[model samples]
Target: MSNIELNDKKIQILEVAEKLFSEKGFDGTSIRDISKMAKINIAMVSYYFGSKERLLEALILYKTSDLKLQIESLLHENLEPLDKVNKLVEIYINRINCNRGIYRILHFELTSKKREENLAAFAELKKGNLKSLETIIREGQSKGIFRTDVVIPLITPTILGTFFHFHMNKPFFQELLHLNTETLYNDYIKNSLTKHIQQTIKALLVYEN
Candidate 1:
């Protein structure tokens, strides 16, 4: 096939794969499903993306690149570090709310065997983002806007928790916390953001020097 033909097919496969993987999840969506939805042959899907797992990696890379660029652009110039931390969460949360499915897929794949081996690229990207957070937190501490005792290495999970739990758990959250389902979506986030961000900022900024 010609290069243009391959490019068109690859784009189509990516589009179909993203929606299917996001909606049906990695385990549920098969190559046949993607091929069928894409109106292409299985070989073509595999040929274009190499494998289902690679297709997903491509999807994640696409989403991450765009999002990271936006974040870097927003934070590139002058801004307070603590405020940047809050903006990080706010921007992330806003992005997730807009496209929860992609976040869900990324959350799901981060644990998969196929994804684990292919995760070195993602790890680098993640490390870069974490470094940005660390820098902001450190700066906030210096400014006395946050506590001085917070350790950057120790807080990655908490930041990830804020992102993951919101998408992964909702029914049990409502049942256990006895909160309404509909309202919990946004209201819970508002509450969590206010409390978590403030406490996280303080905990990471507490006196260490």
Candidate 2:
């Protein structure tokens, strides 16, 4: 097969694995299950990812590759610290809303008592995002615009937990806010939810005394 076809087949397998993993959990999923779902032979799955563990690894890298790029690019932009924080909130909400399946799988794996070894891959992603936030916080602090006593560790989880909670319980939130249609709910997520997170983070970071 051509390189393009080869890449497409790999992605198709990854996408199928992501869906099955989200629904069945990682340990519950197998390479044979993925091949069956993807309508390809078991050997093809092995060829693409080698093993179940390797498949999950590839899925993590594939799904998060763009997000890593976005965060890196954001760090280089000439925006002010507060603007950078605000943009990061927008990015988080939008990405989480769009890729709930992968995030769900990651979350499950992160918290699973049976799967401690998988923590490294997820921790690396978390570390990178936290580092980006730390950079912005430090810049604001150095400029005397943000508080020196900022708790970076707590701040990172607060942003992620809040945004993830909102998206994970999206159906309940959609009903609570009376956003019946998907478009209405999406608008609230991108605009209202994004603004809320930005304000919360600003209150946490901005210097008062």
Candidate 3:
């Protein structure tokens, strides 16, 4: 379902579902749990979403709606291609950091056999984001800033995979970096990690010859 189609009641249910699903895995979270937490009746949720799985699908669409706007805005900016790419990295890092819980839910659900049907929900979103990256890369290539032989498919994963690896191993990283406080961890993500991902992508895109 599109974000425009969601009313307050539907958004409330999605918000509650995202929260519960993040705290508890998709399989662990039920429609009743969402309705109870949302202070609504089960029938209302069922009427809106039909089932727990559909609710999850709706939540994915709702949460990512802003991403399209962000990418589109960035694309419209007149910055140099490489600079735009760096800003894109910042956007992605900030997005994942801000919505870590929802991403975690997606990760868990993707692995579970019960959530097979929901795998495609992210495909269109990923495709859109990938198209944005391709736009920037094409601009860079056209201007001789980036190499023509760039492996387009590897670019998104390189950025996202690096961030995901760090997120999944936050405890190890916290110990390794000695980030004892929540503030320190967040600061590291916002500063150190964001720059690192930007630089990594920069290296991947910059022309070698």
Candidate 4:
């Protein structure tokens, strides 16, 4: 469901759940914790979402709704292929950078065996995004702006993996690079990291033998 469809109560529960899930894993956080943090009755939580798994799915839907719209808009834009890629990289970097905690919860849920039932929703979200990226790549190929020999499945993961890897290793990177302030670090991410990802994707898509 879109953010517009979410009522105040649902939004409250989701915000609480995201914070708790980020601090404590999905398995570690309970419905009661969410209700308590949201200052609502336990029954209210149950009324809104039948179970914790369902609540997680709802959270994923809420967070990704805007991202889906952004990707669709980018796909329909009349910009050049590389420009589209650059915009997409900026989108991903900004989204991930802003929502690092929620993404950590997502990574935990996807990698761990904690909540298998809830994973279908997350998987579908990922599949839809990959399909959009593939569509962009196909459009580029049709225009002879991108190489036809590239493997489509690997493309999304490469970009995502690179960004996530850096995020997960933020402290190490900060130490290694001697970044002293959050502003400096974030600027590096928005500028240097963004440029690096764009260059990587463009190289993959346009490089010729």
Clashes of each: 7, 0, 0, 0
Give the clashing pairs for model 2. Answer: none
lDDT of 2 by residue, 95-139 (tens): 778888888777656475555475456567778888888888899
Model 2 gets an lDDT of 0.81
TM-score of model 3 vs. true structure:
0.92
Question: Compared to the true structure, candidate 4 yields what TM-score?
Answer: 0.91
Top lDDT prediction, candidate number: 3
Task: Please identify which of the two predictions, 2 or 4, would achieve the higher lDDT against the true structure.
Answer: 4
Q: What residue runs in model 2 are displaced by over 4 Å at the alpha carbon?
A: 1-6, 114-116
Q: Which ranges in model 4 have alpha carbons more than 4 Å from their true place?
A: 1-4, 114-117
Query: What order do candidates take by lDDT, descending?
Result: 3, 4, 2, 1
lDDT of 1 by residue, 1-209 (tens): 11123367777887788788778778899999999998999987777777776777676676676667767775675887756776777766666666677777766665654566665656666777777777777677678776665667756566666667755787766777767767766776666754575566555555545
Model 3 agreement with the true structure over 46-75: per-residue lDDT tens digits: 988887777777777778768778988999
Which residue segments of model 3 deviate by more than 4 Å?
A: 111-121
lDDT of 1: 0.69
In candidate 3, how many Å is residue 67 off? 1.1
